[model samples]
Target chain A: MARASGEAVLTRAVRILAVFEPDRAEAGVAEIARLTGLHIATTSRLVAQLVELGLLSRLPSGRVGVGMRLWELGQRASPTLSLREAAMPFLEDLHAAIGHHVQLGVLDGTEVIFLERLSAPGSVVNFTRIAGRLPLHASSSGLVLLAHGSHDLQERVLASPLERLTPATVTDPRELRSLLARVRRDGVVITEGHIHPEATGAATPVRDRHGTVVAALGAVLPNDGRAGGVVAALRAAAHGIARAHTARTSDSH
Target chain B: MARASGEAVLTRAVRILAVFEPDRAEAGVAEIARLTGLHIATTSRLVAQLVELGLLSRLPSGRVGVGMRLWELGQRASPTLSLREAAMPFLEDLHAAIGHHVQLGVLDGTEVIFLERLSAPGSVVNFTRIAGRLPLHASSSGLVLLAHGSHDLQERVLASPLERLTPATVTDPRELRSLLARVRRDGVVITEGHIHPEATGAATPVRDRHGTVVAALGAVLPNDGRAGGVVAALRAAAHGIARAHTARTSDSH
Candidate 1:
């Protein structure tokens, strides 16, 4: 097939990869073609080339999955290394205290991409995994981060449709704005039954030395109708991570 | 400037990224060009494209480092996701008890690439990092994995040049062979001063339900002449992770 340039092919390859989600780990050629909006033949050819280079692995049934080499390279030089490293100790402490799912999330474009997650074996039912993404209106971490996000980002998100995961999720822009206002004023967010009917989310903003909100540290707990010191724990951990990150930033300089 | 295909460009991008070490986060265009064996102009062009794609970021001094987007994508669809997830809780327990540098490593070809690490603030001086690589003969995790690795793979490493990192590092093939044999027999490896003079590493193999060696669970401790129950802790944790991974594997099916 004729193409524009090498760069265009690379971009197409990236788009093809973007089709696979956290839940869908493997995909057949036809499914990939349909999802990526590329011709099946082109998709097949690209998948072959990527598999050849170990950027993707072929399953026994010939479907493709993300390659270990790709993951290795990503880990080798990830930009979020500093923040993830800084928050990990605190995430551990929080997970120990809460005995639930503790997550560290950062604002990635318009989504809150979880950087790290510490989970207990039989804790709250949280579908959030490391590197998982959640909408700005359906998670407490998202709300805390979005509250401190840029004005343009806020307006852009408010302009878009907010999908609801549960009936308790705030989908109305006006209501979401008010919720964000509360998060900004209170320095923490407690969203009940947002992602799951039985779970509640609490999050606090993590900041840098200059007091710039860098990430949201959060935990998913049983919706027992009480904050149960989770707010205090998250805020304290956020503060600890912020101070650590700030010190690390200064050390790097 | 010219190239073979778009795939070649992706290959070149990976090569450029391969120049960075965990200790060295950022590099100048000239250094990257020299290390990647590409013309400076071509290297600059590729760097610009990568930066635009958010796979690499530019530093204040015009150097480039790994980008956050690249890291996020890597984590989102990594091959080691399940193993890392399954081992996290047990790794935390081991870390809490020992309070050193607890790491999870998987064998990638002849190298042991760390998948996750939990480090205490003033723990041992460990060179191993999350996503960092260690030679198959230079770390305890590497030794444990190599001990259980395929015969062909083991032969290949033993036949190659065995680089020495410290005085205690066994470079003689016969000695290494014996050491590996001991690891296999004892079900663990304790490497003293292999990576550093002051650090001792202990590691054990973690197997999946199908009895495949999936990962190495290990820790770096002070080389203070006593294993100090660290070995027991690691083995217990490794056993726990293996069972957890097996359960997850069964559940997924």
Candidate 2:
């Protein structure tokens, strides 16, 4: 195969894998090929290779799904696991103290994939699920990630479609630009625009040893406009997580 | 390359990936070659290809580590994420109700690899880490998994070396046989071996729709003989997790 053809095959493989989301975990090869816009033969061959490599497994019913080996490899390779593990205690503290929905997310591509979430009983019905993705311009974690993200990433996101998630969402690129600027300047985001009208979120960046913002720690509270204390708690939690990360790094050495 | 050579290369790649752990995250090509008994030239070529494929990444300091792409793909391709997501709420409930270390583990080979754990403030210090492995004949989760595992797996584990972690660990194959029988009959395991002397763990199996034990949920309590309630909580949590798993599978259809 040509270099471009090999790259195309790899991209198709990724696309096939991407089709297996929280809603769709198992699919036939024809379904994958149709979803990925690839030839059925190519999809079948690639899926077979993946199964042979233990990246995918075939069920007893002959449907293909993501395999346990893939999960083991992913769990072992994920940097988010370390960060989430370190933040769990503090997140639990904040969740208990504030009695809201606490979340930890990391930037993956242009989206925020939630790593962990703790919800209080009778909290607002939040749609954010663990391992679920949200746009980088909608949620509070997305705002922190966008604010701390690279200039190129910011420009790319600004140029792309900014779908309106709610009536309060800032979909205009110019307004979003200004909002991201304010987030960078203020070091926090309090937004009611992401998914629910009755919920507001406060997010702050969790920095690594090199001072790079690696993740966002945030909490979702009811939109009663009493978010100042929540913001302070989130910032403190982020700081605690960062300190724990540093300590763990040093301790492991 | 010949077919056998291709298989060797693939196996070598897996070995290279296996060498990287939370403790040893980065290594040089020479170290990988030395560890896996592969030629330096072959190791270099394979590592370079893996880097190109985004399965491994080269650091600025001239060492290589598992890549973010691998992490992303792994996260995207694992059933473990779905399992963890379904189990987290009940795990949290158990942690709060028991105020001890709550763990979820799955049988991997003859060992049990912890998938998730929730610890309360001032919980007993245990060796269970995410992705960490423990022997099948030792810990409570291990005993549950081994007891419910396939006969082939049970025999293999029985034949393998059961390294004694503590003086209380059951290393005798004959005693282990009877203990596994008891665990199978009782549907739970309470073990004081393979970890701290001051901690005792009670574990129960979480079964899927096919009635196969897919995972184990356990709680580690301080060995002050106040473990009856904790064991009940663990069993209840395991049942809750199994119900959640069934609901998720049904909802996916």
Candidate 3:
């Protein structure tokens, strides 16, 4: 019974945390209770415990926000952080060369979650943010991931109703399937106005030592005649990142 | 009874999470159970629950590591993320100009925890990593924060035994107190061989709208005559980050 209750409490905690989105970083006990559908007293007790553990912090406004300890814990050992650290040098090089937005993304569920994004001032307007999600059928990074993902994942995405973000997003399953095939064959992808009319995304796969595609390295640039250069840069950076990641992981073992 | 058990579970969960440090990113259940001092059965049960919630993931090596979902949740709403986002562009600029290491750090307890670090290839050796911590009297960023910290915090740090990372590290409370006074007056701090012999750290305080110091922007470069240029660039970038942070927080409200 104690074990069951503990699991239930963890589920509740996760639910409460899920509500604190990028835009809404803090909330009161009552607001959290409402959002998580837990009793006010229970929410208060759990929140107090979380604050004591340094997983949540009390804000000046008498609300609570995610704590620095939580971020530290997540960053210290998250596999994503390892991948991100390995790719960051190459990402910076690509960012300097391309002079726009460079990102590293991985497939999460059916969406692509960006792990890191390096942007320059007055660069192309990009909708993607660090830790932001984009649809698999509607982003260059997403397309590359979807094309290389497992068959079950691909079928599940193709069977669902694809949300069209702009005129250029591949909404039709048939067209998206062909696009995936081409991306797999070419090992790179460029999507003009897929997410935004003013931006173009080009991505390539980053692989592990076993030749498994692990992440997507992409650049978002202006929708101009500059994609040819971007693709070559991305491919080279991806290879560099893959080599570095392999070296890093192997060194640890 | 349920509430008390739930809180205990959360504490245990945090203890388990805390064991995954930079050098040890993944661990077997038996190792975790031993490290956390929980029964093997309890640890296995809790780890299973954590995996179900996506807070931990199972690796092909049959070990558990910090999950990508945990990193996403931490990055999405942590207050540190806002400060990091605000300072990133300026940090990048400083990195490019300095051609070494640039970082943003905030006080966590008596230590300073780096929120972000931009490093270049073949740059000067830096001991600090993103999410890494350094003693308040042994790092330039830490000294700047310590100099501007509250009286209670200052007293606590002074009362404790100051760790000596290098021969030049400030160990005498009287000397450290004087150094703190100088940092507060000059609004910047430079430490030579405090943590490492071949590296120098220069930092300036980053403030919010109310003029309260919230972070320290610093650069780790070679302990050479180039310290003058780095100090000027760090001061400029710190001001830029402060202004950007104030603007971003105000715009949100």
Report the lDDT tens digits of candidate 2 across residue range B130-205. Answer: 8788888889999999999999998998888888888888999999999999998988888864567988988999
Candidate 3 chain B, run of 10 with poorest lDDT: B1-10
Per-residue lDDT for B159 in model 1? 99
Q: Which candidate achieves the best lDDT against the true structure?
A: 3
Residue-wise lDDT of candidate 1 within B7-69, one digit each (tens)? 787788778877766667889999999988998987998888888787788988889998776
What is the DockQ ranking, best to worst? 3, 1, 2
lDDT for model 3, on a 0 to 1 scale?
A: 0.90
DockQ (model 2, Cα): 0.40
Ranking by lDDT: 3, 1, 2
* Model 1 ranges off by over 4 Å: A1-4, A59-61, B1-3, B19-21, B27-31, B57-64
| lDDT tens digits by residue: candidate 3, B133-189 | 999989999999999999999999999999898899999999999999999999888
* lDDT of each residue in A50-97, candidate 1, tens digit only: 887777889898888988777877787676788889888888898898
Q: Is model 3 an incorrect, acceptable, medium or high docking prediction?
A: medium
Candidate RMSDs in order? 2.1, 3.4, 2.1
Q: In terms of DockQ, which candidate is strongest?
A: 3
Lowest lDDT block of 10, candidate 2 chain B: B1-10
Q: Which of candidates 1 and 3 reaches a greater DockQ?
A: 3
**Residue B105 C-alpha lDDT in model 1:** 95
CA lDDT of every candidate: 0.86, 0.81, 0.90
